[model samples]
Target: MEQKTVTYEVQQNVATISLNRPAVKNAINSDMHRELYSAFVQANEDSDVRVIVLTGSGDAFSSGADLKSVATEKLGDIDYGDYLKETYNKLLLYMDTIQKPTVAYINGIAVGAGLSLALACDFRIAEYDAKMGISFLKIGLVPDAGASYYLPRLVGVGKALEMSLGEPISAEEAYRIGLVHKIGQPEEFVQQLLTLPTTAYGLMKNVMASSYEHTLAEVLQMEEEAQTTAGKTKEHTMAVQRFLTK
Candidate 1:
């Protein structure tokens, strides 16, 4: 059997999608993208998977785009924009649309598109010493894979531009600047994230994502509708009953 470039595993309602190409720091390649998309789709469809976690195997989360594959293509003959529109954009759109809570467990360095992948997640928990940045400028390119959309929203325009134009920052600085939700030992962070009530977390993530682009009135209405939907969930009903008993 051939090894998968991306591996998906579900345990106790948590679905983990791991980038398996540790030899090249699990860089994003065409095959990995296909595998990742499939894995995410499967996780989203699985009734038992309440939360989805994305991480990479080995020491690095991902170095960035697979330059090796890029080298194989005829640079001038390829339309990079079309390439991104077909692959990464689809993946990003799927991540955005999924109602399940998604967490990016940045266990090590995440650069360029790797950082963008992390940004796509609703929450990011990185190893304390991990490094992250968008290094597209270094290579005479602009940030892709939704970095342009997510980074500025995450760390603010000034900080986002600075990071894009400069070097990678330590996870500690990333957390301080609001780029990441938390920095801790990977295992501890994963455990804490998994403890969150999945239904509530998903609804909250939807509200937060909507807040970025919606007017206050629109968001309030969305929140009202979401609350109604959430209130119908068995988890919410059970929790409410428990509270009443208490």
Candidate 2:
């Protein structure tokens, strides 16, 4: 499918899918959402693709929802929850569980749902100058698009609540509080994603996400299961052989 809001390309087994509406900081609308999902599907299905990197076109990663579009909408008894069910909910779930490791390359400002999208990623690599915000309460809305779920787990409930209720934070503060795993150039991170034993990464990613809800015995069983699966991969066999030789 032709894409206008997102740009997709594959090189060195990496599928880099970028949000392309730099004019407005890549603010998402329905078209962008649909195109973003399609790009993700393409990357996930391609045999040559092992890593997915999501970034923005220009300086800003994303500015969240297109408020102008919302402003233009015929406001009435419009069901916001239903709107999420149709758009962000599905995208977030798919992204959250996309088997392969996904990185949100935060280039600049990310607020509201844009921040939520980053939270959906397995890892977040941010530029030093990037700024992040929840910005929901500022508009009298609460967090959506998986922010509520990922934030508390990411930075703990105290920091999450503070950030959500207060001002936007700098990239340094984000990293200090565990909002981002790394704050540096994203190129090295992308290269590592492309070259790493990502099959094992995918397996571990799923198990890790599921471990949160599973009991210790159940988690042990899952570890056994995931280990068995990972042990069978060609990458694992090669890695073990490489280790033995060294």
The model with the greatest lDDT is 2
Local distance difference test scores for all models = 0.87, 0.89
Residues 1-246, model 1: lDDT tens digits: 133899888887889899999999999999998999999899899888878899999999999899888855587787889989888999999988887778899999999999899999988999887999899998889999999999999889998989988588998899899988888755565667666667777788889877978899999998898899888898888888988999
Error at 33, model 2, angstroms: 0.5
Global CA lDDT computed for model 1:
0.87
Q: What's the distance in Å from true for residue 80, model 1?
A: 0.6
> Clash totals for all models, in order?
0, 0
What are the runs in model 2 whose C-alpha is more than 4 Å off?
71-73
Regions of model 1 farther than 4 Å from truth: 1-3, 71-73, 186-197
What's model 1's lDDT at 164? Answer: 88
Cα RMSD, model 2: 1.3
lDDT of 2 by residue, 100-120 (tens): 778899999999999999999
